[model samples]
Target: YMLARSTGARIIVEFGTSSGISTLYLAAALRDNGGGRLITTEFEPSKVMRAKANLAEGGLIDLVEVREGDALETLSADLPERIDLLLLDGAKALYPEILSLVESRLRPGALVIADNADFSPEYLERVRSLAGGYMSTPFGDDVELSMRLG
Candidate 1:
């Protein structure tokens, strides 16, 4: 929430929307930011339905679009010209691929937060590398927080 609020994020892309818990947080941030959009993906149709209900119950349905499909496809197209924030909490092994899909759209200094990133050593190395164009460091336990450098 702080990241979204602090960044004044207007467009957020989330790799996972398991049960809409994290989605709620991001949607709240968008609402608090005075209006924005959140694009989150979930391959499970049941989970997607639950998430939509949750969002509606929270009165945040209007700010979020819960895409029911694989992140690789859902996040691949029709994205805003500039993405302010990205949350990676889906398949750990696919972190690098997901990052690549969103990398080009990330505005300069945009934040990228990854949960349970230890499972993807390649992803850690990529974000931590000086030449990767991201300034990154571990945040808390297994979360890696990075910002696009350019």
Candidate 2:
């Protein structure tokens, strides 16, 4: 979250909103950054409700929009013109596809963080590819952090 904030992120798109744990963290950063939008997706209806409630309790619901559906569908349309930050923590199998959907909108120098990236070798490979338009490396244990270079 601080990484996103320190980089001056104002438009963040997250692929998972499970229980709103990470949502709250990102939203707090946005709030402290003087406000921004955090668009997050969750496939389960129950989780969506829980996440919404959690965000409301954190007083950050206004800063977030929870899209309830498969991320491939929910995140495929109506994205911001330029995304400053993207967090991928959804169905591991769809990481590459989801990245494709958002890749064109990523601003130069934008950050893409994929959690549990070990489960998506295709995603890791794409980001690490020499022609992938990104500079990427494994972050910590399970995360893959990539930055848009163009």
Candidate 3:
């Protein structure tokens, strides 16, 4: 949300909407920006249904697109891949996949915010490997960090 608010991002993409906490923040940011769109994907259909209802309740159905199916697969070349920010809040095992997807899609200086870094070995390694352009937030948990892919 800070990214969107600060940068006035017009296009944002997020993976995983388990409970829709981050989704709400993102949607609100987009709405408050006067114009923006957030496309969120979840593998499970049930989760998508719940997320749609939750987003609607949040008064953000129009600004958000809840896609049901494999998020990685759904992220086609034709879709809005050049994101201002990409949030990865799901499956640790898919960290590499997420990174690859971002690499292909995200624009230079785009931010990739990842979750559950401490618990995921693959994610940690990927972060380590990409240390050239990545750094953790110094203030708090350090779990929520950003990388400027240039």
All candidates: TM-score: 0.98, 0.98, 0.85
TM-score of 1: 0.98
When summed lDDT is taken over every stretch of 10 residues in candidate 1, the lowest stretch is: 65-74
TM-score of 3: 0.85
- Tens digits of per-residue lDDT, candidate 1, 32-129, equal 99999999999999999999999999999999988989888988999999999999999999999999999999999999999999999999999999
By lDDT, the best candidate is: 1
lDDT per residue as tens, model 3, 10-73: 7888888876778889989988888788888889877888888888898988998777778778
lDDT of 2 by residue, 68-116 (tens): 9988889888999999999998899999999999999999999999999
Overall lDDT per candidate, in order of appearance: 0.95, 0.93, 0.75
Off by over 4 Å in 2: none
Order the candidates by lDDT, highest first — what do you get? Answer: 1, 2, 3
Q: What's the lDDT for residue 139 in model 1? A: 95
Per-candidate RMSD, Å: 0.6, 0.7, 2.2
* Displacement of the residue 101 alpha carbon in candidate 2, Å: 0.5
